[model samples]
Target: MSTQQPAGGRFQTFSAFYPYYVHEHSNRTCRRIHVVGTALVIVIFITALVTRNGWWLLGMPLVGYGFAWVGHFFFEKNRPATFKYPLWSLMGDWRLFFETVSGRRRF
Candidate 1:
């Protein structure tokens, strides 16, 4: 899916980027992997805080991005939006995660 840009040729707001983000995750497996990756990231974060394990903190990106990359490369068959829109992409991931878990969106 193409990113619909405004006159500036960029998404000026997250609301704009979100639709493109959703389009990018059209593959069911990709969305599922993203949800799982985000969940694991949250769990890892809590573990790191509870156990004072800085090493676990370091594993967050590895686990999260690894699963996401697998989904993207093998399933989604497209480059991740993260490479271009890092902050918004992360926000999209968490939003999609909560939406899926809360029944607002499908798994």
Candidate 2:
């Protein structure tokens, strides 16, 4: 498959990009790490809101991306689609997390 675009020249919509996103996260460990990171990000966001301290917000990306990057580098041994498709990749992360939690997808 070509990495230049999502199945074609470009992904016209998130639905179009989703399959590619899932494909990039084929590694089970990578998917689990992403799920964990996303959950932590959600918790941090809530903490930031509850404490009314914006500083906690700063760690959101760090926590999320840190786990994800480690999974990609060490487990998946592949580059994250985030570099090429930031918005879609972020959306995919949440979608995958929910799917896993709902038992629609394996963790």
Candidate 3:
């Protein structure tokens, strides 16, 4: 896969970036917050579509990143990987969300 690295890092693959992603979220609360934020983002997306309230779409990034940044700042005590690896970090979030929920990885 290819990416547009706005933060100018060397991660070439999602497979390669995932380990770092996992490490950044080592805190339990951070991971839990991420799960909740991801779920809420999904709900927000569906709500936007169902309700046809474009305003709800505005909350997607706010709710998603707000919770994520809170986890990073308070629990992880680190910067979010999203700042550097936007696409991969997003991929990581969904992958993590699914993995945690589907029993492939522990919550």
Candidate 4:
């Protein structure tokens, strides 16, 4: 895919980007890690709200990216989608999380 973009580097809508995201995470373990990571991020957000701690914000990317990267390195044995599609990767992470949790995706 071409990395070049328009003048402002605009992006397509999330819906348009989602399929590409799924393609990037074709590995099951990598997708699973992304789901777990997204859940942890939600928990962290709630904890941050309850505790009013600024540091919890630091955990957002860490929890989301850390588990995901580990899964990619160990199980998927492939580079992460984040490197090429940061925003869509993040959106896909959460989308995959919800889809799995809601039973939309078979285990």
Candidate 5:
């Protein structure tokens, strides 16, 4: 089933999209991958701060997305929300990452 929003419309709000986000990350490996990706993003952010190189900020999405997509392709075996909802997918990525790290998420 296509989760695509209808033309000239926005997708569901983050709250509504949350359950689907959790469903997409149901696999433990996927969850862990997201965690690592999120950590890498933080590292990149720190590097950017220390070096004062704004370009390093670009690496955040690269680290976050590259690792997450690898997990989806090899383990979750599903399409990434990036293909459908780029911003929300990124938000969901970080949200899920924190949830996993904080032990608030059930695998």
Candidate 6:
């Protein structure tokens, strides 16, 4: 698959980008790390809401991206789609996480 984006230079829709997103995360370890990061992000977000400690909210990206980046660098050996497609990449992350958890996709 082409890791460089489509012929037109950018992804016109999320639906088009999603398949590429899944392809990028082909590594089992990478997917598992991403899932763990997402789960931690959820826990951190809830803790921030419940305790009213807004500082904890700052950890969302750190925890999420930190783990994901490590997985990409060490396991996938590729750059993160997040750098080029932030919003869609985030959506892709959650979608993949849910799919894996639901047994629709492999972890």
RMSD of each: 2.1, 2.4, 4.2, 4.3, 3.4, 1.8
lDDT string for model 1 (1-107, tens) is 35554565678789999999999899999999999999999999999999998999999999999999999999999999899899999999989999999999999
- Clashes by residue pair, model 4: none
Global local distance difference test of model 1? 0.91
Please give, for residues 1-107, the per-residue lDDT of candidate 4 as tens digits: 43333356544766766766676667787778788888899999999999999799899988888999998898888788688678877777877888899999743
Arrange candidates, best lDDT first. 6, 1, 2, 3, 5, 4
Positional deviation of 84 in candidate 6, in angstroms?
Answer: 0.8
Candidate 3: stretches off by over 4 Å: 1-9
User: lDDT per prediction?
Assistant: 0.91, 0.90, 0.89, 0.78, 0.83, 0.93
- Ranked by lDDT, the better of candidates 3 and 5 is 3
How do the predictions measure up, each by TM-score? 0.91, 0.90, 0.89, 0.79, 0.84, 0.92
Residue 35 lDDT, candidate 2, scale 0-100: 97
**Which of 2 and 6 is the better model by TM-score?**
6
| 1-107: candidate 3 lDDT, tens digit per residue | 22333265577678878887888899999999999999999999999999999999999999999999999999999999999889889999999999999999788
Worst 10 residues of 5 by lDDT: 1-10
- In model 3, pairs of residues that clash are none
- Summarize candidate 5's per-residue lDDT along 12-103 as a digit string, tens digits: 58876767777787788988888888899999999999999999999888888899999899999999878988889888987887787788
- Return the lDDT, model 5, position 40: 90
| Candidate 4: clashing residue pairs, number | 0
- The residue-level lDDT of candidate 5 at 105 comes to 83
Model 5 TM-score (2 dp):
0.84
Error of 3 at 80 (Å): 0.6
lDDT of 6 at 30: 95
